[model samples]
Target: MIQRPRGTRDLLPPESRLWQAVEQTARAVFGAFGADEVRTPAFEPTELFVRSVGETTDIVHKEMYTFEDRKGRSLTLRPEGTAGVARAWIENRLHDRSHPLRLYYIGPMFRYERMQAGRYRQFSQIGLELLGADSPLADAELLLVLHELFTRLGFDDLQVHLNNLGDPEDRPRYQQLVRETLAASREALCSDCQRRLDENPLRVLDCKVPSCQVIVADVPPVSTVASEASRAHVVAVEDQLDRLGVPFVRNPRLVRGLDYYLRTVFEVVSPKLGTNAVLCGGGRYDRLISDLGGPAVPGSGFAIGEDRLVDLLPDGFKVRVLGLRRLYLVPLGGAARAEALRLARDWTRAGVVLEVELTGRSLKAALKRADKEGFAAVAILGDDELAAGTVAIRELATSSQEVMSPAEVPAWWAGRS
Candidate 1:
């Protein structure tokens, strides 16, 4: 049968509790924003994504998964998570410690693309980075930790957008007004915007090809090349997200392909995610550590994809794993089935989840298979409660039975429910 592979799948039991309740509420909102976990390395050095996600981005020209390494080198398979957390802050000098170095990460991120509905070609991401500061409260603490992790994951209608992409002397005059407005319609666009109209003219205004969004719908808005010191760093990141009441949306053709971003940029959209793209995106790279050779320390980060957030949650959700209960021991044959398998292995060594009917089922079919596996009580030990040294405790959702005493059925199944 040999199956399961193409774009992966297979997380069964209770659908992995929507990835452990959105990865334990995104690790308790990355420990309430103090950020700490950092584990980068699922392959790299494919020129670190053509030098920090550029080479005209389509996640590095036509979806990366790259190869080469049996010594030849190239290597890839990383497709995002801030260039391996900025190549582990420049090969671990972690800028010799101190000053905004907060961090975070949650795995899996290959990208060959083309899978739909919450997209996945081996996908999953959950990120947050904030290295050193350049204030504006580090872009309002990344829009207040993605607005408190989409309001603690219930995600009721979101949308934070906001953009600036300025600085680095105003992104080369907004990439020369998007290459003189896509060179007067580079032969009517889309051939991947005519090879990205000279490698990334704001990714041809993020084309989604409705005839290249009806030919860049009158082109213009790269905030007409901003720069009054990048318009006061976009009004100091929207006056600190309007002095922290935080709700945003400037959009204006938000570019973000990462050549170490300069001015603020963000995204957190979701009108219940069936459309408006991003569920989390981040910004403010501030010259990604002196353009990846370290020494220029400013940063910002965000990522989230817990496998398309378990198809955007809200179905039967379960994570309450505190079960442990079986204690069957129903011996009715051959020397009380060897003393019901030695008192079901000594009531599972004084603990609990013990079982016996090794396929001889009869105490009402082993208490109906311990009330279909959700057993919160079942300690019979038949042969007439092993001739009264006691052992009954049935409950199984109150079918009520209690006889007790085989050393008080491990303190009566620890005072059950």
Candidate 2:
């Protein structure tokens, strides 16, 4: 038998229900915020990521799955959602529609990398982007939306780690400060950090190596070298969050891996993961549009790792979505079996989740299967019930049975609901 590739998964029954519930929640929440869905290709020209996500970032440098087409043109599966959305914003001329476009996307992203728990080579991301807006209020609004999403998901202990990456002008100075500070400990740094120090020093702060983190701990905070304007920008964002009751912490070391992010960058970490897994990460990328050969448009958004989010979903939500009360119709004789479809359709149309048993199984065997599958109730139709135009509904939990007319089944199910 052929096996699925490593770092990939098949979302099977019940669990697939959880994923659907999460996506449905995202749609309702985002739609309430005046955001419409947008979809781009799963893959695009390789340069799209190289230009937008940054050359030195892990996504562009190591993770992306790039291949040449028949024409020998390079195309890559997207590793993140924002860059593709930015490309779409420009190429489709969406920027001309309104002052700021509120958009959301739910899709798969591909990356070739070492897999770990809650991380995958093939993953799904739910992203929201606010384009053409540069106000501090816009940044606050994005965070607010995230807070609302988490609250709706029943996440009680998620932390929003915020930091100032500063404007483009302040980058050279901050990078110089980072390099100068880590110079003495360069030899002790990991090979990745050492290379990052020269190529892009900010990436060094994002290093996960224990030793590299120790050396990077001594580096000065980027805010020290950040411009007064950028500092004030983040301050206003914090103020807005405070007033809005969106809890967050100013992590001097917080930095996103992408190159386009500047001014405001953040990660939402879940304490339930024990390892502080980041379920969502995003920030302000004001220059991304211009960098992608489009008019300069400021954008702010974040992408939630749907795989990780579902893994840590609260028990309350799981029970509510997965514990659906369904009716299993067991038709015992040939006539009753033939009538099963009509009964099932009527109950289903009445908003009752009903399943008709078509296989030739005895009433005892069907009841066993229904109990095993966690059905709340079973409707039994035999020759006697078919002749009397009645059905027997048995509640699995209580093992109690009730005889009712076929037309009364809907009301009975509604009362049970």
How does each model score on TM-score? 0.34, 0.98
Residues 97-125 of candidate 1 have per-residue lDDT tens digits of 88788888888888887777777778779
Per-residue alpha-carbon lDDT of candidate 2 for residues 283-317, written as tens digits (9 for 90 to 100) = 99999999889998899999999999999999999
Ten contiguous residues with the weakest lDDT in model 1: 315-324
Residue 55 in candidate 1, Cα distance off native in Å:
27
Model 2, poorest ten-residue lDDT window?
270-279
Candidate 1 Cα lDDT to native = 0.75
Model 2 segments more than 4 A misplaced: none
Which candidate number has the best TM-score?
Answer: 2
